[model samples]
Target chain A: MNFDMILAAAARLDGHARHTPLLSSPFLDQIAGRRVLIKPECLQHTGSFKFRGAWSAISALAPEVRDCGVIAFSSGNHAQGVALAAKAHGIPSVIVMPADAPALKIENTRALGAEVVLYDRATQDRDEIGESLAVERGLTLIKPFDNPFVIAGQGTIGLEIAADAADLGVTQAELLVCCGGGGLTSGIALACATRAPGLRVRPVEPEGFDDVARSLISGKIETNAALSGNICDAIITPHPGEITFPIMKSRCGPGLTVSEDQALQAMAQAFLRLKIVAEPGGAVALAAALYRGDALEGDTVIAVVSGGNVDPAMFTRALATL
Target chain B: MNFDMILAAAARLDGHARHTPLLSSPFLDQIAGRRVLIKPECLQHTGSFKFRGAWSAISALAPEVRDCGVIAFSSGNHAQGVALAAKAHGIPSVIVMPADAPALKIENTRALGAEVVLYDRATQDRDEIGESLAVERGLTLIKPFDNPFVIAGQGTIGLEIAADAADLGVTQAELLVCCGGGGLTSGIALACATRAPGLRVRPVEPEGFDDVARSLISGKIETNAALSGNICDAIITPHPGEITFPIMKSRCGPGLTVSEDQALQAMAQAFLRLKIVAEPGGAVALAAALYRGDALEGDTVIAVVSGGNVDPAMFTRALATL
Candidate 1:
């Protein structure tokens, strides 16, 4: 609701979150017929931007409650982010994850010293499980999105993007972001609105899991039929978050969607061009930027590679697709 | 020779070169029994630190001579770095390369709009070919590592490392670098000497091509028996540069070498842990840091993943090693 909250989050995450580099490639520029700046959050702490929101939410909690514990539900990135942040604060944490989530993600969350509670995406509800754990254990719930502090924390990236763009002498550019519950999108949109007014922020989603794109069009929140099948497991939230949708509706341009093949192709391109690993979900914004070239404006465009916590098998498959 | 020159290069490369992140992993810390800070230059422009030296050398030439053109001899990374920097400066550039170098390197260099002249590594003399071309075309020669401007340019990374380490509260750390002609090693060593006094810089090489390592011990330059067989083609210089070796000898602790298998394993480990692509040559320093645990001192260790211009087949092979 307040842009000041995003600024507050930026101050809080100063020494904690990485001010990830804004990378460009002549090869990618030629492909899109324009300059493209890549914000590689794939290199962020915990291998994703989720750490920003996780830290923001947990750090804002009352000390006694935080000391008690925190509960979260994520397919992977968010779970690890919360686990690591909690550990940093010396607080007990538990994460509810899909049993089918990337093996690397599950292993990483556990490695961060978080208790893992697995549930079946086919028949069980992760939120219900997380909620029950929170209630039973008297733990604070840090929802992946739909939280003010979490949204504000993620908005810090927008501030960096705006500042970096201005530093590069780019006054205006098309900004593409990987979207799930619209938390990252809305947060970034808010920052761009105040800091880099010339940027046109847009949300990008996987083809079948484009609830946010549909919601943006209808001017209301929408839900996906199912959440289990996409290779982009990280951004397959069922719908846009309540707190995030209003902000996105006010600030974002039309959302875009990319096919599974396109996402895999983008992942491969990122490896070849950016020399950074991008998980399926993380590559969607790049996929949109590459495939939806017609929609881009100005000579410069920016895309965020949001996460890189990919399983070896999945990465191998993405590489083979190239 | 002067640290002030490196400071000038940092200024020149301010907006041009990426101020790459200093990444840390607890997993790697547990393995090495020390905290490891990864400088992912793989995310750098041209996918390597070579751009720094290339720009430094080319940009220092007189305007008329620079406008006339430039020529250089390199296996891969330097070629691309020179090509890209030349393109940025709107100057013509020619690169003489080993015909057996990675195909991806050749393709990328050519794609950057450089004229690539391939020479047989076993029979043909690349330097002679480059010299002849430079004389014929009135092109200025930009020696990859031996040039003072180039060394100063590469040294900019040292300034960044020191600043970043200080930000992380790491006053002292063991710095490991992949060495070829020792341009990068000497450059960083110079920066550390003036900027981060507590850092102990060391050069790393492939087992068969430990010319720099051997030279450090003998107090004179040494040459590798063969340059055509190593998987780390980028860092397979016959000997350390005259300008680089003396500086390295004066500042560096000692040189280290890793076997081919160790390099490959390190490449895979980088993929798994850092989620970044590191070429075999680029992964050598990381190999030393991860495996040569006994050699490391202090709680914090910094290793440079210098380049990521690797052929797909080679990367596939490296991944398979995991």
Candidate 2:
């Protein structure tokens, strides 16, 4: 919860994870009516910012725990992140994933040398299955967003954004972070609070799954009833995490939500202007910035594109939507 | 031609140009049989490395010359680069472009506030038309690749590649550079010869327009019979430039050529793995690295994805091919 933990995580991740490029586009700037700086974490290892938390958590484990290996449940990005981080640490990893997850994500997780355990999302509880597997196999469970190490790890992105913005002589700006279970948003809020106090942090979510937005307004946690219908699968967590919600409430401003069409437009814009591929979940913040320009409050705005592990068919569909 | 000019260009471009991210891919490494370091110029301003050269050339012009304006002939990337650089300098620009050029490029060039004059590639002599326009308007003619400042500006990318590779403990590698008129290739060759002495710099060209490759083997300048048939319009210069040829001859190894299919496949792979959009010409070097794996040497290899100003249809076609 403290800033020092994020700094320590950054120290651990230095030279290990990619310091992804902060890109700018004239076309995007014109649409938002402000200069837009994109922190493209799609370029990060395993194609998401999840790797940072995964590596930080696994690498900090006790020798005995490390030897016992680890287990996690994710539909895609987190699975690949934990799998790759475990492989780098020369430890075994078992990932419990939904059977209907994107084929690309499942294949990539397996390609990273993780044992895939598929469960029917509608019939089985992923948490129960993952917990039992971890217990029976004597493995440490790496929670996707609820873990302290993961939050601290994701905070490294905020550190980079502050540093990069300062390098450009920008002392004040607004940050739009794509929100799922509030891990990335809260982590970034904490980092910006300490590293660049002038920044105004906000969370962006898809329209149907705006738990974080409603929670911020209500000053409490909220849950989404339907998740399988949204295109932003990577960020369709049922509700904000218990640990992450308080930090977001204290540090973040009101959240913003974008429509599916807006998200698709943002993805197309990222491809056309910045030349980076962005997944539907990752492009939500950018969508808010581009489509919901009325909320912009600074000369410079930063959008965190969280992941790009998209199936080609989905990517084609996004382009076709544009 | 000297390294000092490149250093000076780097200084001039310190805060103005993007120090583009150097990306690595495990999938690409598996294909090339070595670690592949990608310098994605597609993320650069104006969607290509041409911006560096254009800025270098335009920024160095005399006040009166800049006031008189600048003119250049290009298929697309260079046109947009020159137009943007000229606009930044508060000067007018006129670009002579092929009538059949991609609509996106032409639209972008005009959007940057450039005057576009179209000429037929099959009938009209573009060079003569460009010269006549320059003379009539009393504008400075900015030759795309045959100029010294532009070459030095492009050389900055080589400096970055060498520094980034060394940071990762890679002192030796084979460099695959996309070749048009040898500006980018020769500039990189001189840079590698000076900065990373062990790097084997090789030029990559399209199959039918392999003048650079033929010239490197024959120890003389060569020319392509036809120019309008190739899909890589951005790099279909009939022959290597008069100024760039000497630098390539002295500092570069033999050039390599890839078929159009290979280039398209490379573009698709860039999208699937690197998550960057690459034009056909820009992906040629990566094609050489991926398809011509037998020519690879050392533990590390660097491929320059030069530009991303590709038409969406072309990009869709590339993805469909995979």
Candidate 3:
């Protein structure tokens, strides 16, 4: 919610979370026709940046509350992040996941020591399951992107980007992020606004699921028509979060969108150029950075690859594109 | 050749080379039944740790000699490393590559601004071609691993491992490195000898092409019966290098070998767990760490995923196994 809170979240995350790397490649630069730095949060614990927010939120909770455990509803990345963070904190976790979520994510969540409760996306309400479980078990429900602490946790990435940009002698750049609920985008925007004023945070979304983009342009929250068809399942929220939309509207730059094919291409390119995996939803920002260059500003663009909890079949499909 | 040279190489690489992250996963730790830390050099420039040695060799060269350009022979990763390093120095580079080498590696090498000279791995001699080209063009021939500067360059990885280990409070661990001509293994061994005395470097090679492992056991240089025929092409060397063998024999721990299946499994695990690409040869060290734990010592093991210049088909194959 505030600068000091983000600093406090970062303090809690110290030694507990990974300081993910900012990577670059000449091939990526050549493709974008500009300097492109990628912050691969996919390499973070649970293969996503969600772990930062998960840990931040869990660690910030009063010990008594934290000991009561945590609950979360996610399709994949957030579920695994919370699972791993809770396990690290020696607390039980209950994850309400869509039955259609990737099998790998489901298995990984369980493997990370979480009790997974699967629900039908079309019939059962994950929120209801999660809420009931949280109440019955006396567990704290950690919202994926709407909570202030999670945003503050994700904002730590902005602090790192600011420092790395300073080291690289970059005065200005577009900080692109794959947007689902605008939590990552808004969080980064807040962090960069004070830490690296020259760097601007921009949200990039899948073409059909560009709710955040539509909201930014229309000056109000927007919803997508459909989401399940897209391959980038990790970042397909129906709408931006209530708490996140206002912060993004005030602090972030205009949003951009990339097609599913472009997202797959970006995933393949992340493997080829950076040797790091980028799950389809995670690579939309990179796709936008590489293909939608005309819509972007500055000579440098920093894209945050949000997650890499990809199924092997999808990964094989991405590699097939090359 | 010594600790000072590695320190100097690290200095030269301060801004030029990527300080690759040492990554880990609870899944990987579970599989290995130990605390497994992975140094993903696959994220380094040119998708391999070869860039460190290449940059060190090229940068340390006399300006007049370096201006004449450099030549090298490689299957893939080293070619790209040298090509990129030479280009960074504003010098031309000539690469003699096996025609049978991965298509991705060949294309990447040429894309890195190197002139490619293809040769038959069975019938033609790459060294003769590289030598004639170097002599004809008054260029310096940068050996893949035999040179002192090259070894010193790769030694920087050991320095990083030592420092990161210290940060993680790991006083002792087996530092497993994927072996080829023993350059990477020996370089790391020499570095760990002084910087992390408790951290013993171990060379891990593919089963059939386990010349380094055989040599270590026999107490003499050993050669592979076949020059080719493994998925781990990056490390299919005929024998250990003259310079490298001595250092490896003296400073490194007992050698380890992993099967091709294990290597591919490790590659898949890297993608599934660590979200990083690791070519088959590059994953051999990780394979040993995961599968050959009986031969290893300590509660912790650090594996260096040496490269990621994998062809799409190979990557698909690795993914298929998962």
Query: Which candidate's DockQ is highest?
Result: 3
lDDT of 1 at A267: 88
- Chain A vs. true chain A, TM-score per model, equals 0.95, 0.96, 0.97
Return the top candidate by lDDT. Answer: 3
Worst 10 residues of 3 chain A by lDDT: A97-106
| Clash pairs (backbone) in predicted model 1 | none
Docking class of 3: medium
Instruction: Please give the distance, in angstroms, between residue B121's alpha carbon in candidate 2 and its true position after superposition.
Output: 5.9
- The lDDT for every candidate, in the order shown, is 0.89, 0.89, 0.90
Please provide, for model 3 over A123-204, each residue's C-alpha lDDT reduced to its tens digit, 9 standing for 90 to 100. 9877788788888989999999999999999999998889887888986999999999877898899899889989888999
lDDT, candidate 1, B1-322, per-residue tens: 7899999888888788889989877778877888899998898888999999999888878899899898888757888899999999999999888888667778888999899899987898777887788889899988889999999999999999999999999879899999999999999999999899999999999988899989999999999999769899889888999899999988996888898899898888888778789999999999989999887777888999999977667888888887
Error of 1 at B316 (Å): 2.1
Q: What DockQ was computed for model 3?
A: 0.79
lDDT by residue for model 2 over A185-304, one digit each (tens)? Answer: 888989999889998899999997999989999998889989769889899999999989999999997889999899999999998899998999999999988888887786888899
Q: In candidate 2, which residue ranges exceed 4 Å CA deviation?
A: A100-102, A120-125, B99-102, B119-129, B132-138
lDDT of 3 at B223: 95
